[model samples]
Every structure is written in structure tokens, then in C-alpha cells.
Target: MRGNLATSLRRRRRRCPIAQYDRLPPELRRWLAQAALPWSPVSALRLWHKLLDETAGNIEAARQRLDLIEARMLMRDAPRIWGVPPTVPPRQPSPAG
Candidate 1:
């Protein structure tokens, strides 16, 4: 299954029910719809809550943050999976305000 596909993130052998998916925030559901990786509800919701707080409830910002994280993971795994060097530099954290 796609959920069992190899990724930079560790794989978990568990079942995710539709009820779990239905309980996700609408914004997160939309984000997951287009996500390149199949994210489990538990992990996705964990990151969603973290990013929501970090972005001060700005949904779009959280979405972009997810994109950046996925991009970094793909880049990190490229050499191992695809045998190609990463094309982009790792994102640097912004200075604290």
C-alpha cells in the first residue's frame, strides 16, 4: 500500500480507520489530499497542531510549512532512493523576533 511506501520518515505498521481521517481538521484534510507522501492521521494531526500554534492559526502558513518540510524530506532521501544529489539547500530557520 502507498502508506507503506518508503520515505525519509520511519514507517509504522498500523491501521488508520476512516473515523480517524474524518476527525481531522478540514484544513489538514485538504493539505493531505495533495501531499506527496501518505501521512498517517496521528502524525499529520500532531504536526498540524504544532504548526497551527507556531503559525498563530494561519492555515495557509501551516500549509506552506508542511510543504517545506516535505520538500526537505524528499531532498534528504533523494540520494538514497533515486541516486541523485539534492538540488536545493536545506532551509535555514528564521531568526527569533
Candidate 2:
């Protein structure tokens, strides 16, 4: 059935390591390094998610202030992949919608 197929697909996708830092700006990387330290497997992952959400919010706010249409455009066009959702709600609906 369709449900079974969807479940199987989800399982396959879950095996892939989602890319959380691939497109991070250098400044954001510096922020993350500072925020996420004394790394243990569990704590490191929690820190990474927290940093990613904070970084995304800051970037979106900057784009709003500067009225940089292209910044919004680039963010809009970026690919959606498996990762933690931002702490802030996304400006647009998710692709899964």
C-alpha cells in the first residue's frame, strides 16, 4: 500500500547523513565554534542545532533590514534536505507541504 511505500522511503532517507553545515557562512562558523564547545556526541549535536537556528534567524533578519531581494531569493531557492527545523518558523511553508 501507499503507506508502506512511504514508510520504506522514509527509512531509506534516514540512513543518509544530512548536511547541516555545508552552506554555512564563515561568520556563522565562528559563532558555532564559540557556542558549541566541550563536544560530546549528544551535546555537540544539540549545540549544532541551536547554532543553525540562531544563524538562520539572524540572516533572515539582516535580509529584511537591507531589503536585499537577492538574499531572500537565494534562501528561497535553496534545496530542502533532512535536518533540524529552525527555532524560528520558516518564512515560507516547507517543501513537504
Candidate 3:
């Protein structure tokens, strides 16, 4: 896994500074720290805002929704990156009831 990262496609982009990261919501900071994907602040914030709107600002719900999204992304990338075929279709998020 460590060796794979060295050969992964690198995106040309500026990085968010630690001070700027400190200004993000504490919950988001925590989530980013432990997230499976290396999400940029701008992209994550955009999704976070969308989740907040969808969940009526429920932080836990937003976090769970984010996890579902990340899982789908991982499943989509697994074949290309790890040469592992997906055993099952990725689960779609259920409509909010």
C-alpha cells in the first residue's frame, strides 16, 4: 500500500495550509483526519454543505452519508488501482424517509 502511493497519479494542485484547516468546522477536521480518501478542503466542504442540507444539519447523519459516498468511490476505484474486481455492486444511498 505504501509503495502504491508512490506510483499513484498525482494531481497538480495547491495544498490547504494547516492554519486554514484549523478554521474548518471541528467535525469536518476530525472526519478529514480519519477519512480513507485524501479529500481537499474545497471538495469536502462542498459535499459537507450538501449533506447538511440533505440531513437538516444532522452531523451524525452527514458523517454516515459521507461514509457511504466514500465507500462507493472506493469500490469504483478498486479495480483500477488495486486490480481487485468488485464482488458486488456498491450500495446506493437510500432516499431520506
Candidate 4:
């Protein structure tokens, strides 16, 4: 079964020579990110396979785009906590002996 799946994937690659996610256009990558939502193990695997098949030819470019998208997403989603100074109690003087 695994062999059959592999063969099927190979056939698909031959039919569509486009590179993997690493080679995809920024627009396409963004589309993929949207498609990949509702994160679950199964969804992740499907997304991974899609990316792998799509990026097989243009791995480097796809990877670069993916990285850029990830960085942007991280920056957008970063926490926005306000700055606050810590308050420490004053040290008590030692009692005379």
C-alpha cells in the first residue's frame, strides 16, 4: 500500500512539474496558510504532503517564502504587554545591639 501511494505521488509529480511550497509564490503561500487552518494532526500531514509535492522542484525559493511568511505572522501575533516597573519594599534598618 505504501509503495502504491509512493508510486501514485510520483505519477502526480510527473503530471505537474511545479516545485514544492518552498518554490511557491508569496500569494500561493499565503493561500496555503489559510487553507492549513483548524490545525490538527491530519490537517498538518495533508498540508505537509501538499507542500512537499508542490515544492519538490523549487525547494529553496519556497522555503524562503515560507520563512518570510512565518516571520511576518509571528511579528503580527506577538504579545503587546505594557511596561511596568517592579515595586520592591524598602530595606529595614538593623536594630541596635
Candidate 5:
């Protein structure tokens, strides 16, 4: 899977097409390098292109969201909690009325 922090840390990753990778701003390049997905470039590159269009090319903020998600995933260790505990009926008054 892509964006696995541990594997990325152990590998020296290069995005396919060095020129394209080189053209990215330094910080974005660093982030991608760290993210290092195991996916094929065809899909991921095309998806990123589409996302850039969808977000109007706000790359930095998207990267920030990625980082936030990654951090939260790392910290997540339990099932998610939900609102509204179940209600139980009060016991009826015993033999009296």
C-alpha cells in the first residue's frame, strides 16, 4: 500500500520520470518521497493530476492534509466511538400497584 511511513523511511524512493519529480517544489518532493506508495505511477500520477484540478492546484494544503491523515492513522489504536448510548427501560414498580 502507498504512504506507508515505515517502508518509505527504509527505502530511497524516486518518483518515476526524474524530470517531473524534479520540477515539483522541494517540500512537496520531500513529502512524496516520504509517502512512497507501492502503486503504479500511471494511476497515482493521473489521480494527482485530477486532484490538482479538483482542488485548483492547492498542493501545499493537500499535502498538509495528507500529513495530518498519516499522523492520525499512526496514532489510531482503537475502534471509533459513536454518539448516543443505548437507553434501557426503568424497572416497573414491583408487586405494589
Candidate 6:
């Protein structure tokens, strides 16, 4: 029983990371999986660049949150409904037609 439990744990650890990768937005997940299974050198490199671009976007989002913290912004200071744009729409299209 104990041996089986340990084996299950090991499998879970390996599966968790891949599962997390699967949870990523569709485009990133596709590139990441294909990057792991490279067909050609050029393809691998291109996938790496695509992954980097995705990470860069996430980094920018983190930087924005950090900026808010640095400015001593509190909960109320931040707007509700994350991913929703403010008055200028913050890179998002306006709700109106």
C-alpha cells in the first residue's frame, strides 16, 4: 500500500506541471507542447520565441501589479473586474458599438 502511494505521488508531481501547462491559454499550450517535441531546429527556435513573447506579456501584467503596490494603492484603489478596461479601455475594445 505504501509503495503504491509513493508511486502515485511521483506520477502526480510529473503530471501536475504538464497539467498546469495544459491550463495555459490555448496558443501558449500548443507552442509549449510542440517545442518539447521538436521536428526541426528552426521550428524549435520559433516556438521558443513564441513562448518568450507569451511570457513577456505575463511579465508586463506582473509589472503593472507591482507598480500599483509601489504606489501604495489599496484594494479600493484598484478597479474591480480584472481584465476589464477603465475609461480608456486599457488596450481593450469599448463595450459600446
Compose the digit string of candidate 5's lDDT tens values, residues 1-97.
5567657356777756766666665655676778734333444456566666767888876676656655665446223443454578999888975
Q: In model 4, how many backbone clashes occur?
A: 10
Flag regions of model 6 displaced more than 4 Å. 1-15, 36-97
Error of 4 at 60 (Å): 0.3
TM-score of 4: 0.29
What residue runs in model 4 are displaced by over 4 Å at the alpha carbon?
A: 1-56, 80-97
Better of 2 and 4 by TM-score: 4
Clashes of each: 0, 0, 0, 10, 0, 0
Rank the models by lDDT, top first.
Answer: 1, 3, 5, 4, 6, 2
Highest lDDT: give the candidate number. Answer: 1
Off by over 4 Å in 1: 1-15, 85-97
In candidate 5, clashing pairs total 0
TM-score winner, 3 or 5 = 3
Expressed as tens digits, the lDDT of each residue in 1-97 for candidate 2 is 5667656354543322224443445544444455423323343445445644755757545323323433454456544533544577558866994
Kindly report the root-mean-square deviation of model 5 from the true structure over all alpha carbons: 13.7
Ranked by lDDT, the better of candidates 1 and 4 is 1
**Model 5 TM-score?**
0.35
Quote the positional error of residue 13 for candidate 6 in Å: 10
Computed on alpha carbons, the lDDT of every model, listed in order, comes to: 0.89, 0.45, 0.89, 0.52, 0.60, 0.46
Worst 10 contiguous positions by lDDT, candidate 4 = 12-21
> Can you give the TM-score per candidate against the true fold?
0.68, 0.24, 0.68, 0.29, 0.35, 0.22
Pairs clashing within candidate 4: 19-54, 19-55, 20-54, 20-55, 20-56, 21-55, 22-61, 22-62, 22-63, 23-62
